[model samples]
Target chain A: EPEVTQTPSHQVTQMGQEVILRCVPISNHLYFYWYRQILGQKVEFLVSFYNNEISEKSEIFDDQFSVERPDGSNFTLKIRSTKLEDSAMYFCASNAEGDRYEQYFGPGTRLTVT
Target chain B: GESVGLHLPTLSVQEGDNSIINCAYSNSASDYFIWYKQESGKGPQFIIDIRSNMDKRQGQRVTVLLNKTVKHLSLQIAATQPGDSAVYFCAEIGAGGYNKLIFGAGTRLAVHP
Candidate 1:
């Protein structure tokens, strides 16, 4: 089965540095999403992207965060100034339809900022 | 505001036994629910999902039951095995655009031999 794949399974960056997490969603998927799971916390939605524009975002996705479909196959999340609190498991998901459909998740990129 | 929560934080069961993980949602407008399993060091994997219009849905050895009135959802796994041990999360998509999912705290299921 085709699955969403993310690069840099684990990332370590210095505080105040920029980090870009990359994902290649299923080729045919139209809706892409970003979520983060703090250690021992529930998964939190960050943003959703469709048609090269952000559909929705949460408070957690503030000024420091941005998403881009840099290419036909790559969906990426960029954090301008990484904070200690930003360290978490960042996941990328995609679906063929927007709602009521199963969104497939990638293995996730563990971001560690020190 | 929307919140999804699990009834239990952890559950331990003997191998070959049945396991049921329960969840409750505060958003009455949520029209879709899903259960996901995440093993350590891996991402959440889709288990099964149910639409608001359906009371029950089944797949493989797992079954999903949704109660719209009480805003409850449950996943039942029959003859659980050691491999079934994982953290289970219940997620909901509220009615509206984008269909962003809100996830519950999750319940850890431990299957013992």
Candidate 2:
């Protein structure tokens, strides 16, 4: 089965530093999304991207966060200025279409903001 | 309008026993529901899913039951094993937009030998 893959399984960065988490979704998948889970907390939605534009985003997705699909297979999430509160596991997911099939999740990138 | 909730925070089960994790969703418009398992340091893994049109859907060892009237959902794992220990989350996707997934807080399942 094709899986979503994320780079930098673990990332360590100081406060106010810039960090970029990358993901390569399934080749044939069309919809992509980014989510974050604080330690011992519920997983929260960040943003959803399709057709090279963001369809929607949650309140947690603020000016500091941005997503880009630089290439056919590469999707990246950039945090312009990291905060300690941003420390969590960032996951990338993808699905074939709208709400029909389940979205497959990546192994995740653990962003550690210190 | 999108809030998926779990009835229990944690569940302890023994090997060979069946484990059932329950979820309740308030959005009656939610047409698709999914069950995901997340390890200690990993992301949510897709276990099974059910659409609103269907009342029940079954996978290899997992089953998803959806009750639209009450807006409740449940996942049943047969013959639970030690490796099955993890945090399970129930997510729902609404009909109109693709960003409709509302995830539950999650339930931690500990399967002991």
Please compute DockQ, using alpha carbons, for every candidate against the native two-chain complex. Answer: 0.82, 0.69
After superposition, which runs of candidate 2 have C-alpha atoms over 4 Å from their true positions?
A98-100
Alpha carbon deviation, residue B67, candidate 1 (Å): 1.6
- Fnat of all models, as shown: 0.85, 0.67
Residue B98 accuracy (lDDT) in model 2: 68
lDDT tens digits, residues B1-113, model 2? 67999999999999999999999999877888899999887789989888789999999989999889899999999999999999999998754586546789999999999
Report the poorest 10 consecutive residues by lDDT, candidate 2 chain A.
A96-105
Instruction: Please state the error at residue A103 of candidate 1 in Å.
Output: 0.4
| Candidate 1 Cα outliers beyond 4 Å, as residue runs | A98-100
Each candidate's root-mean-square deviation in Å? 1.2, 1.5
lDDT of 1 by residue, A1-114 (tens): 999999899999999999999999999999999999999999999998988999999999999999999889999999999999999999999999643368899999999999
Tens digit of lDDT per residue, candidate 1, span B1-113?
79999999999999999999999999988888899999999899989999899999999999999988998999999999999999999999855578688999999999999
Give the best candidate by TM-score.
1
Candidate 1: Cα lDDT at A10:
98
